[model samples]
Target chain A: MSRQAFSWGRLPAPEQRLIKLASRFDALPTTTESLLPYGLGRSYGDSCLNSGGVLVGTRGLDRYIAFDRDSGVIEVEAGVSLGEIIELTLPQGWFPAALPGTRFVTVGGAIANDVHGKNHHRAGSFGHHLLGFELLRSDGQALHCSPTANAELFAATIGGLGLTGLIRRASLQLQRVPGPWISGSSERFGSLAEFFALSAEAETASAYTVAWIDSSATGANTGRGIFIRGNHAEGPNSTATPKGIRLPITPPQSLINPLTLAAFNALYYWRPAAVARDALWHWQPFFHPLDAVQEWNRIYGPRGFYQYQCVVPMQDAETVIGEMLQRIAESRLGSFLVVLKTFGSMAARGMMSFPRPGATLAIDFPNRGAPTLALLDALDALTMAADGAVYPAKDARMSPTAFRQYFPQWQAFARHVDPRFSSSFWRRVTETEVT
Target chain B: MRRILIMGATSAIAEATAREFAALGDALFLVGRNPDRLTAIADDLRLRGAAQAETWVMDARELNAYPALLDEATQRLGGLDTALIAHGTLTDQIAAQASSEMMLAEFQTNALSHMVLCTELGNRFEAQGHGCIAVISSVAGDRGRQSNYVYGSAKAAVTAFTSGLRQRLHPKGVHVLTIKPGFVDTPMTAAFKKGPLWATPATVAKAIVKAVQRGKPVLYTPWFWWPIMQIIKNVPEAIFRKLKL
Candidate 1:
């Protein structure tokens, strides 16, 4: 099987050697060389890729172990996806405590990435909700890790990018929701300052908040976009399931060039009905709009695109984000979707988790070869200067220096990484051989 | 809601189909060789809105276990309205050619075991005078290829057996469906390079659900496989023998 990243970015193809983990615990302990747990390949970067190494495919290990309806606690095997969880628990008045941009990601992947969402300002990242998990080491030892048990290992493995060991099963504290419907409000902001002000107010008023900036805008128009905040609505609303529309095939390279992106962005930002709209949305459309269009990434054309997501401290957010947007506009290689959000003051639980009390911005740029690389490198420099870090889950080509700089605890985290397990992203950023 | 029984519930195709049934609030008795996987599938089904999801673990290759398993599923599900047999293995043709035991094991698992289960289920369904029996055959069985003839031959036997079973059950008002799916992107075929002709397990699952509901006698999932298989089946052996598939 040809395994590709979600971004569809070009990278060194990994040797596709996969061992399907059985659902039975007694059936496991299958010995393999340099094994990495491969979930649903939803990560945008090569964090899930192990070039020339073995991958223990966890998709087969999907099983629900236990659920407490009263307490809203559920225990499930690592392979179960967030979408599966929502499908099962939403009707019971429970939902995942935290969710990423897409529900297609697996439990193990969510933990490994410590993924955040629109509600990061309220609930924090995925790791914050994990009550406990079982980590099966390469040496055949199964360690029960949590805040109180194997605390250091728990911290290391949370955002360890699957390098610590194979995550077998995890127990999570599911959030209680009134219903699956979201009462959402969207406000068009004139500039970056306006977005910050809206985000501050929404952070307290709503459970979820995020902004979509038109990255193509330059000078005074830079950071001009829409801010959306939403809260779970009470009672039953119409259960309008999203009808998936798939991109049948990859289009030609000209499909997502600057001209098309600019027009789309402008039309999206200035749409009359979207200027200050308040609407009721099903959870699917509100949280996973991209999922409604299956294989939407193919719209970026055959070459694929790269997602650059970074977070800078609240103090330097304005200058750093402003400079980053200015650089992107100058390059004329603007993204189709550029999101900006604010993280709360909640301390990160995972040692290497990306979320911090700061401003995070994410943008997608079509892979335009050397020029694109150069532009991204410039943005990385800005992020580094702001004393911020790029998310490893979304990075394909961050330099070793930048990685070391961003994650100052790399050496400490590296110590906990299973010697037998490694990934393309780990290899690239660490510049080390698995042996 | 329909009461359904899925054999080899852990198989990717069967799992996907079970999910669809669960989403429709069907009652299910899932049977699979792996206890952990069976439990998992059942739990997922229950969560997905299945009225009741029960599981039984027994190796389908052990033909003697068929009777008891069927009894348990029927008893648990309160009488099955539909049953799907989707247990099979794709063996290495080259290895099987060198080893008679390998070929026999493949044949037993893919064809003989299924035939046994179908016979047991067919009798009950016929006696009940209403039900559906759906078995997953393969497009590979349409014609033998030198590369995987051992697996192909087993599927061929299954296709022929189901046809006879369908004929026998029709008068009794028991519907029998033979599903000849083209190359599906399942774990069984994960090693093979995929192309446009390939379909996902979900796609095949949808076809299976539709076919069972409509009481279709034969189905080629993705529909396009009907013509593609026809073209291959019609090839002259004289020329086909010279070319490698």
Candidate 2:
């Protein structure tokens, strides 16, 4: 069977192999061969892909074991999706402390990536809310790991990219909210300095804050975009469900060229809604706007797209980001969707977690073959020079040297990875053959 | 809010459909083979706005337990306004061809067990005289191909049985819907290569829910499957026999 990432890139036709469903943790297969725990396949890059190995699809194991309404604590199978969690918890005035851009991502994927959301400035990454989890190993041993119990393994497993073992079930602390609606405001910022100023102000006022930069802009208008800041609203949620629009097929590659992107970026920046100062928003629209369009990635065409995300230290954030944006503008290859955000002082629990007290930028580039790869390489160099790290969850082509520079603790984390488990990303970054 | 009973509630399609009902604030009585899984699903439903989400554990293959299970579901949910049966195994076609035991086991799990539960639920729904009973049949049942005739034949039995049940229950205002889904991308079909033809479990669940509400006797999920299966069902046996599909 062929498995592809959400980006629709790296479609490897792996030989179909079955890993029998384990109704209980005790029934998990005991095997020495490399295995990857597969969930909803929502990962954009190679982290979820195992080229020559077995993938144990975990969606069947989805179940919620326990939930305490009073304390807002919940235990769920790793296969459960954030969408399912939201549907199950939102009515109870609780939500996942940390969420990704999409609700389709599974709990296991969130932990493996240590995903951060709009609230990273306040809530940190997904690993911060993880209470404990049960890891089933190839030797048929189910180890319980938490901050206090088997803490090392717990740290390694959080952003271990499913290389540690199969996460069967996990307990997490959810954040209690007033309701599902977000009382928010959006303001247009003219330059990078203004963005920094607005983001600083948002930190104290809003629980969730993020900005969308028009990467295509340059010179005096560089970094011109909309900054959205929000907090949970105290009222009954508006019951209107947004009708999803689907991209029926992959369009021609020429459909999303430089001209189209520039126009789209300009139109989006000057939109009336983007200029609006305040409005009430639903959780879905505020947290996962792109989700309203099903298979929206198809707009990038069949070759798919690449998301380049990197974080640099707070001190060097402005200069590094400005240089990167200048390069993108000179190349005339800027993407339509560009996001910039700042991380809070709260530390991430995962050893390899991507979030830190710094500024992060993410941009999506349609796969235009060599030019796209070359531009990304230049961006990587800039990030590395600023003592920054690229997010592995969104990477497909980071060189081993760059990976080592980005995550210096890889060698130590390698010891904790299960010998019986490996992934394409792990192999690519480590340059090691599957055992 | 409706009172609902979902047998095999842990199955992907059933779980998704249960979420739809839960969102509507329905009372649910969930029954599944795994007690832990059932309890977990119940907990999720409770949090999703289900007025009351209760669970019971019973292996569907145990036909003798069908009556008691139905009784418990009815008693727990107070009354059943809707019930869904969404469980079946996709057997290894090559293995089933070589072993009679494999074929019989597949039949027992897919057709016989469902028939037993359906019969028990039919009687109760008939007495109540106002409810919906939706069962998931497969597009493979439209016409049996050599690739999966063992699984297809069992689904064929279900389609035929549900057709008769629909006729019998229609006059009494009890609805029976047979859901025929084509190439759903579920854990059951995870091993198969998915393509444009594949649909998500949530998509199929939405169709099933809509079909039940509209009192449709038969439905092809995703709607396109109706025409696709029509073409497949019309294929000459001479041509179909030579094709590997």
Candidate 3:
């Protein structure tokens, strides 16, 4: 059942041999091509795509191994999505320690990408909450990976970008919450400086904090957007799962342009609860909002898109963000879905996990070929000059040198990558020279 | 207030269908070959709000143990409202063609085992005079094609057997449902390339639960399968035998 495998952003849809593994215990689907474990295809870039190889689709391995309601420790097959975990555990007053913006991501994808969520400032990356996992190599060796045992392999698999081997099953340490509701708040920031100020203040007060910058804003309005923060609701309780409406079709061309971006930003910045001094929000909207539109990526049309996320040091964050915004404004090619957040000062559990102590900015742009590539490279230069790093999970075309710079342990990590497994991203970054 | 028994409980479709019943607070007794998977599923069902989630490990093709297995599951759960027989394999047609042992073994697993379970459950339900028996057949059974006639013929036997069972049980206050799922994306069919016609296990499981609840005798899951199978069933042999399906 081989077909063209497309990532979430629909960029670089590669012709892949899709071998679905129904049970974790079963033998790997025999293939002459290199293999990469694929769960949910939630990675936004070529990191999940294996061109001229086999994509072992692990979604069919969705199963629960063990769960202890009292201890809040749950073990599940790698293919199980974070959304399903919440559904099974929330009623018991438990939830994953960290989750990305989308709940559709699989547990294995979360681990491999080392995804961080709104509470990253408090909880750290997903790999930090991992208890252990079974790493199935192509040669039929199931290695138990954790901090205390096979520590190097554990670090390599986390943010390893599916290179180490196939993650069969993983046990996660779930965090206990009061209930499913969140006490949220919102405010407007006038500039990049003001946004940082709000972030510092909310650091100790709120468990979850993130901001949206109007990417189209320039000069006097640079970085002016809405600041949002939330904490688990201790008083009110509501446990309703949000219903989703799908984007049924892909349009002929991009629906996002300068005009639409401006309009959407203005309306979204002043959206309902823009000044809700006190708001009790359901977990879904408070966490995963864009998921309401099931295939929202189709709005970018046939060419697909790229999500460029970079992190700069906290000391020089304001200046760098302002410069980046000014450059983006000059190009007049940015969307309204810009995310700004600050990472906590915590040592990474995985060697290549993206989050570090810094201010991170994520911007989206529809693929316009050479222009988009040039703009992204220019931005990468700015980030590298400021001793910053670009997130590999969100990148499709970051230079190989930059990847080596961002993840200094790449050479060491390369020593552990399963010989039988590789990805388009791996080849693009390492130039396919593993030795 | 239903006590459900799931055979081949580890199948993706059976697991999803059991989740629906578990969410409704029904008691479920699951039977499967893999003891570890069965235990895990039972535990999952309990956490999903099932009043009682129990497990029995038995290979579905172990025909000699059918009566004892049914008796134990019923005794453990007090009674049974529905019995869902959903265990089968998608044996490679080419391999089956090469080995007679493989072909008959597949028949034992896909058809004969189901007939025995249905007969035993049928007797229990008839005596109780109120129960539902739903077995997952396939639309491939509607007409055998050269590509998968062995698997198709086995399913055809199950479909025909359940059709008669439906009529026989109707007068005894029992309901027999024959489910024909077309191109489901289960492990049994994982090797096949999925297309617009393929349905997810959850989708097929949803229809099965709804049909049993409504006491329907025959169901072509996804509803559209009914029309599609109708057209295939009527394709004249003169043209059908010549064309590869």
Candidate 4:
């Protein structure tokens, strides 16, 4: 990951790897240069980025070194995508312990973000499953590190946003599922109060839970959503084998407007109840519904969209979540989908992981204009008031002050790994303090 | 995340490609001859959600200037994961035939520029031992036609260069992708008639993204053009000359 700097949006900063790699040279070049270290390119902001330098894109280095079928242990390159892993491992009755909303992310990215999934309450974040990794230091040395070996670097590298070093490969454990199917049920909630109650109650038993809110809904109906809870199908008798179906390509002009999404959400809110665990389902429908349609992200249009996700502690969950919904509705910057879930445990290993003892909410809104920024600012305030913080993976608008306020322990991690401070995300958020 | 760099950043197709990559929040280095356009496009890319976007303005035709320029771009973008050479010129074949100066200029811009860019990119990819290179060529390069062979010849050179480059680079962790666009509707091709097969800039961008993700070695823009050009390439010389294709 040797590069000089990275950029996210209009922001720019020098990468740590660039500084380290350059120092190794017998004579340092006068001109400033850098390289951007990239993980599956799934981030919503420039956190895992560097620009105006050499970019060490790790996507193609994907290779599955070994997979212990019996123990569900897997060793793979940092660039190995979750989709590739799932395609190869799921059929063998093994699955990642935790995953982000999408399956396109690389293992390096998943580790960087310390991503949590629907089963976060049950299995925790990716850091929990991560056992070790091959780290390519700024000086070009490949050293293997684990909990017992270079433990601080391992902890810092997890959720470190590729600032510590280049993650060459990772070894982790996979979970064995009873079947590819999930026995899921949906219940409608009319308000934030109902939503929180239902979510908390469901967390006690369900292995997976998520809520879909209509960001456009206002007043009494604001935050109204369909709460979904699911557990792995008990056995083969619980469901049938799934079939393969793919939408080859996305139409060049599929507009996902308020009207279109409204109709879709209405059906989504009602349709889940229609199939009340009558039969077995395919994993694609359950896990990667968006994958069915290739390039589905294009539906956001040329301007694209930003996904804002924040986790609010239980103490301030109601007011924070309610105020966020109210502000979003008032802003009129509508979102196609708003998901809510509760995270039960924390992966202490990751330096900057997002999850905590709180209810996490993710809302995707098309970039309309200034109102979008304004709304996000307001949401940030509300989340902060609730003792919450935003997800770094899906964030593009968070301020350094906000980041500092949210992650007070950042200084410790920053000093430990990249004391000189080399990372686009670090440069942008803490411009004055980083380098 | 994918780290993508576009050497010809200001082109319509490159702008669209930048937007697509930006949507994925990829870090990008947009290089071009015009600083204003590069900065403007980079700003626009950021607004569209690029995690990072930077601009570099330099004459791509100056092969000697590439190593430094590339060094700057790579430093700016972090490291080069993939570099897409979207730079090329569209010259009038009749004008080229009328003047040797016109032919030389066209060849420099269309073929030589890409050659230099590809060589530098290929070396970096090889150094890393893993990366992808996507270059935008023309379907006309598959076989020369009487109407635009001058431009076709340059593209043909680029096409042949890319094929050999791919063979050498692919073995060393670099995946070379050649995009042969038949008739893309852009400022360069606006004078031509628009037809079903003539793709929009956005379509070309979409196809390029798909090809990179799929790791396809070579692809015709619309996919159908692959078969169309196959038949065209195999056509008898006598019959091909009589046809106005």
Candidate 5:
């Protein structure tokens, strides 16, 4: 009925801040019992949320602190989103070392999750590129920490779910790109085995490698996928090519479905199976194809979907991924774009941070009621049994047990941060305890 | 808990409305088609501290799917307190004139979709006996201009639907509001120039939230757009036909 609208998830008590210093003062809780800090509110799950306690909004405090063009390093307010950073840096030929699917995510979010990207196998995670950050401790003290200083806090803060302290600002190393163009190639694979082989081969030559799996397939063809590999192009090849088509608007998700997707895919696959080996392409096409369609996520019918992204060690990928897909298909929960990427080394050792030397699979499943949740639970178990972890950015459902099993560091992370630091993701994971 | 459902979860206005409610500690249900973006927005809302935030990735234009989705959303969020019907389409005038299919499609998306949404919302809100509905109609709907009458006609219909629903639901304690944004720089109007006066997402969001809180029956986002559109609407047909919007 007419109830007071609360956020769709449980979060810690929140405090809206207009100044940057508020976020930098680590433990500046209104009271001794409350403590939590968040960036631009980008973390998909509660990793950045805290309930009944202090939640520092970083949105108001965004500002470019400093930049070293020679070294390609930038220091900005923690609230600054990657999008903001890119807008300011892209023209200068600097890019984030690692990015999640979207540019709207904040630097603090990237650091808190130690986010990875399509080029994760080659560049590692956002943590690798981070030089230092300002940490506001639970006691309300701002401490500048890096690998060399306050090493524990630094390590703890990275992928620490914002527990160790509020990140006020961060100095991140920027990637130097030759140009804004990428030379790309797309190859279709008939099976998971081929996909894996192609991915491994592409890793050796391409700057970025990603695969789209057909999760609906079963049996011998359970994991047929499409392989996309790309490398940054050196110079402009085309005298007249659109810089890139950014989605002016995202078509309603109804425009895409199994039938439409099938047609779209069929047409998509028909483009010579491979395109410009060394042709110039805008950075948007190379990195964010989905960005082309603004609000493209609406395609999932009214039954919203969950993005299930998990990284299984390469050794266990085939068995674990095969079983995961098998379960999804058995449940009849179809996924439109099933992406597969190889993770490189982890840059940070934060608990719950998802990245490792393995293969990560991401899929979307419309919420088909209890069956979907049950299926996801089963899949989580499978992922954990294989020592795989889930991506916090793309996660809506993952129990505390699953979180604990996957991220053994959760306890330390939770304990180190303010006890009040919580989120919907955290709430869902820890629902039994609070509810 | 304040239970809010954003129908067009991915719309720029919808996203901003979501952020507003989310920042206010409401439980949010993001209903839209792009499950991925909805999921992303849900995560964002969650991270921003929604008491709880979830997504329903469904095509709003598919009326048949509304009841089932609403049932699930109500259960998930506990219940609905407020619903923001923000889904819309700015049909290309040239394309609509060129093809009958395009014209009908625009009407279906802009007009029929709202009809279904309003029907479902009216039923639920009436049954609940208390709720609020804010529909995003365009100022263009004030009077169909030759530039985009197909789209304007559809919005005009929505504006009427919302008005009638408001009249019927007032006795039931449900508040219905019509939001007419004039050239808000949304994804829908990205191609159009700012043309002297255009509102931003934040401006529209702020206005909508204020109106909802203040219980305003209907509001023009920029306020000035009201008189501006009124003048255009009141202009004689002969005179209107001779001028460009």
Candidate 6:
């Protein structure tokens, strides 16, 4: 069967021939069309998408292959989502060493993107906890990849954007935690400099740390936001995590206009915060706030939105971020959702991993066509000038020159990409640039 | 503990339904044709909070083995209060028409096996004084259409058997749920193009779990199928014969 595949950002994807794979042994179709192993469409951009080719949907391979509660080690089909793993292991007092903001992403998606979470200051990206995976190639070889085995492919496939081949199954080292509860706290920072100082303090105090920036604030309050941090709580938790309610219907048009965006950002930052100062949070709320409202992405409506996330060097983060925020505040085209966090000195295991020693900033801009695209371009220019890289998983329209500049190792990573596998993002950057 | 026995435990809907039961902290004794698949499912169920999971390797069509399977499951789990039969083939109508052997084989798998299991379980549950049996029948059984009457006829038989069994066991405090699911997206129907009418295994499983809990005797999964089936079933034969349906 064939269907049009759209991404999480509601960007229209190209028509794709659909192939359903149930088992690890399922053969890739011998057709000449390119094939990409597509898990949940959780990625915000074209990285998880294929155009005029086949998308091997991995939904059927979702299974826990092996688990050791005692050792906190799990072997799972790459198709298994993080949410499923948590459901299975959390009761046994184990959790993924690293987790993205949303739990909907499959383990394969996490590996393919090398997703970073709030714990980037401590646990690093998802690649660090990955033990190994079985890579099924078009040539019919199932190679076991890890730091020791098929090491190059291991590095390439992690953050490889599903271009290398299909990751059938993977083993991960999970961290042991007390329960499904987080000991958390938050305090507002007055300025961009204060945020940098406070995030450093929060990182030292807690395992998980991230901040919400008020991009609408200007001048003295340029990067003012909330610095929130948490660690797994000790002892029992009486409060139960409420089941997240889904956005049942998509609105006719984008609800996040400039008026609403500015209002939301102001209220989010300054409203006499109701959440307790030293609250014990359910891990669900502490980690996956947006996931709770399933399909909240559709609220951006048919035109969709673009998520711009980039990591600049920690050396000049404040100046770079301040300039970017000032530009956004001046333009009045900012959004409600803005996040800032820092990455530790630990390098990502992926050869093309996006996370580095940097202070990262992410914002969502509702697609206003050329205007939004131009804004995204300006943000990219600032990031590149500061020698930072835009996260491909979060980008829809990054320029080829910018991509090459951002990921200088793209040439090396290109050598390892499977001959028969490619993605829209890969083609957009390389094909257009080369041609 | 919720002790449940799942026959054809590796089928998509069965596995999805087993997941629901596991989340309820059920102790499961899973029966399936493949050892590797069953072991994988058992372990997954254990991780999903099934208090304990045991597996037996045998196809559900092996009717003779079912009694021993039941006894083994009852002995292993201490008791069994719930059983879901969610195994069948959507036999290729063209292939079945060409071979009586293929047609009978499909009947044996889709009908006779389910009927025998129901009879065995009905006796056991009636003797125990309480239990719930959920057998997945198809909406195609309501009125046999030309395209899939072979498979539909078998489901019709199973549905009739389940209905009679439900009446027989109701006085004895047993719940027999005959599931009439419309098109479901499973490996069984992977080749067919899906439309708005299709329901996911999880959706069907959830409705089955709800009906089983409420002791409902009949269920048209997704609820909307109930009216659609009613319209189809009420189509008079005189006019139905003129149409290609």
Query: Which candidate's DockQ is highest?
Result: 6
Give one digit per residue, the lDDT tens place, for model 4 in B1-245.
Answer: 77788888888788888878987889998888877556656664664568898888877788799899878877887777988888877888889999999999999999998998889889888998999889988998989888888889999999999999999987798999988987877767745655678887789899899899899988898889989998999999989889886
Tell me the tens digit of each residue's lDDT in model 5 across B173-215.
9999999988776656644645569777778898898899888
Candidate 6 CAPRI grade: medium
Candidate 1 lDDT, A201-284, residue by residue in tens: 878889999889998888899889988889998845555577888878778763777788789889999988675566788888
lDDT of 5 by residue, A1-435 (tens): 111111212212233221123223223546544445656554543455444444655664354666666788988878778877776666667788887777767788788888878888788888888899987765556788888998777887788766666787799999987766778777677777787888778887887888877666667767776788877666654434334333343234434455555555546544574443545557776677776654455456434466778889889898888888888766666666778888876554554567877888888776566877888889888988898888776676687677767777666666566454555456667555522
- lDDT (Cα, tens digit) per residue for candidate 3, span A1-435: 344436877875877877788777777878779999898887889999998899888887677778898999999989999999998898889989998999998899999999999999999999999999999998999999999989999998998999999998999999999889889788888899999999999989999999999887778999999998998877554555778899998898889987888888888877775777788888888898899899999899888888999999999999998999999888878887899999998777988888998999998998888998899999999999888999888989988888878887888999999999999999999984423
lDDT of 4 at B60: 73
Q: Is candidate 1 or candidate 5 better by DockQ?
A: 1
Q: What is every candidate's C-alpha DockQ against the true complex, given to 2 decimals?
A: 0.42, 0.37, 0.49, 0.02, 0.02, 0.57
Chain A agreement with the truth for model 1, given as TM-score: 0.96
Candidate 5 Cα misplacement greater than 4 A, ranges: A1-41, A48-55, A237-267, A270-276, A346-351, A430-435, B1-245
Report the C-alpha lDDT of model 6 over A1-435, residue by residue, as the tens digit. 454435788887778877778666567777889998888898888887888888888878898889997999999988999998998888889999999989998999999999989998999999999999999988988899999999999999999999999999999999999998888888888898898887777788799988999888988888888888899987564535567778887788889887887788888877776334887878998898898888899888777889999999999899999999998888777678899999998989999999999999999888888888888889888999999999999988998999999899999999999999999899999888542
Q: Which of the two, 1 or 3, has more TM-score?
A: 3
Candidate 5's error at A125, in angstroms? 0.3
Candidate 3, lDDT over the whole model: 0.89
Instruction: Assess candidate 5 and give its TM-score to the true structure.
Output: 0.60
Native-interface RMSD of candidate 5: 14.6
TM-score result, candidate 6: 0.93
